[model samples]
Target: MRHIIAVLLENEAGALSRVAGLFSARGYNIESLTVAPTDDPTLSRMTLVTTGNDEIVEQIKKQLNKLIDTVKLLDLSEGPHIEREMMMVKVRAEREDREELKRLTDIFRAKIIDVTDTSYVIELTGASRKLDAFIDTLPGGAIIEVVRSGPTGIARGEKGLVL
Candidate 1:
């Protein structure tokens, strides 16, 4: 099963490396990871996505909690939550393809952030599936490059992570 584990940890040197090393040492795969300092400058929030059986996930959580820097850990996938990823696609948008690209962008509610005579950079943010679908709608061979910020999530209720 895939799990979105959100972790609050001390913001200090080598903290990220330690967390990643733990997973590497165990041979577990992290599909996506996004980390940044939270409002309380002393801490950082990490949203990590990984796939494993229930037992493996449980182990991962336990090991994470044992880390010196880890302040708290929550598996957002366990309850109501929201996830979003940002993707930017640069595609060939020549004279003939410009109209079609604009139409497709509108359909996906994406923004054409940059425009050149022959190409465009479109930015989209949504669930992973929505991003994938937008890519599928683009013309074949039109894609020049794609950059995605892996999924990040938070719980849906009034509750949240705090110091």
Candidate 2:
């Protein structure tokens, strides 16, 4: 099963490296990871996506909790949560295809952040499925590049992870 694990850790050097090293040492795959400083400058929040069975997930949680930098940890997948990923796709938008590209952008509610005579850069944020759908609908051989921020999520309701 896929699990989205939220981790609060000390915003100090080597914190990220230690977490990544732990995963590498255990031979576990991380599908996506997003980390940034939270409201507190002394801490960072990491949203990690991984797939494994219940037993493996449990092991992952236990190992993570053992990290010295870990301040709090939560498996957001255990509760109601929202996930979003941001992507920037550059497409070959020639004169004849500009109209169609604009229409598609409007349909997806994506923004044309940059444009040139032969290309357009679009910015979009939404669920992973939605982003994939947008990419699937693009004209064949029109995509120049795509950059994704991966999935970051938060739990619903008033409760949250804090140090």
Candidate 3:
């Protein structure tokens, strides 16, 4: 099964490397990873998506909790949460095609962050499924480059996931 694990850790040098090394040493593949500072600058949060069996998932979580810098770990698969990812896509556009592209971008609720004679850079944020759908709708030969910030999520409601 696929699992999404959210880890809160101290904002210290090598912290991300350590978390990544753990997965590498165990031969576990991280499908997606997004890390950023939390409201409190002293800490950072990472959302990691991976696939594994029940036992393997449990073991990985256990080991992750053992990391000295880990402040919290939440298995979002078991909780109610709001998950989102952001993508910035640059696409080639001709003057005639620009209107159509803008229409599609508006439909996806994506913003044109930059525009030039030949290309437009669009910023989009939403659930992974929504982002994928938006990407699929682009015109053939339109995409010039893409940058994605992998999924970042937070549990919904007053209840917090950290323990």
**Tens-place lDDT digits, model 1, residues 1-163:** 9999999999999999999999999998799999999989999999999999999999999999999999999999999999999999999999889999999999999999999999999999998889999999899999999999999999998999776
Deviating ranges (above 4 Å) for candidate 1: none
Local distance difference test values of all predictions, in order: 0.95, 0.94, 0.91
- The window of 10 residues in a row where model 3 has the poorest summed lDDT is 154-163
List the pairs of residues colliding in candidate 1. none
Better of 2 and 3 by lDDT: 2
Give candidate 1's total backbone clashes. 0
lDDT per residue, candidate 2, 74-155, as tens digits? 9999999998999999999998899999999999999999999999999999988999999999999999999999899989
TM-score of each predicted structure versus truth: 0.97, 0.97, 0.94
Off by over 4 Å in 2: none
Following a full C-alpha superposition, what root-mean-square deviation does model 2 have from the true structure?
0.8
- Residue 89's C-alpha lDDT in candidate 1? 97
What lDDT is obtained when candidate 3 is compared to the true structure? 0.91
Q: Given candidate 2, what's the lDDT at residue 139?
A: 93
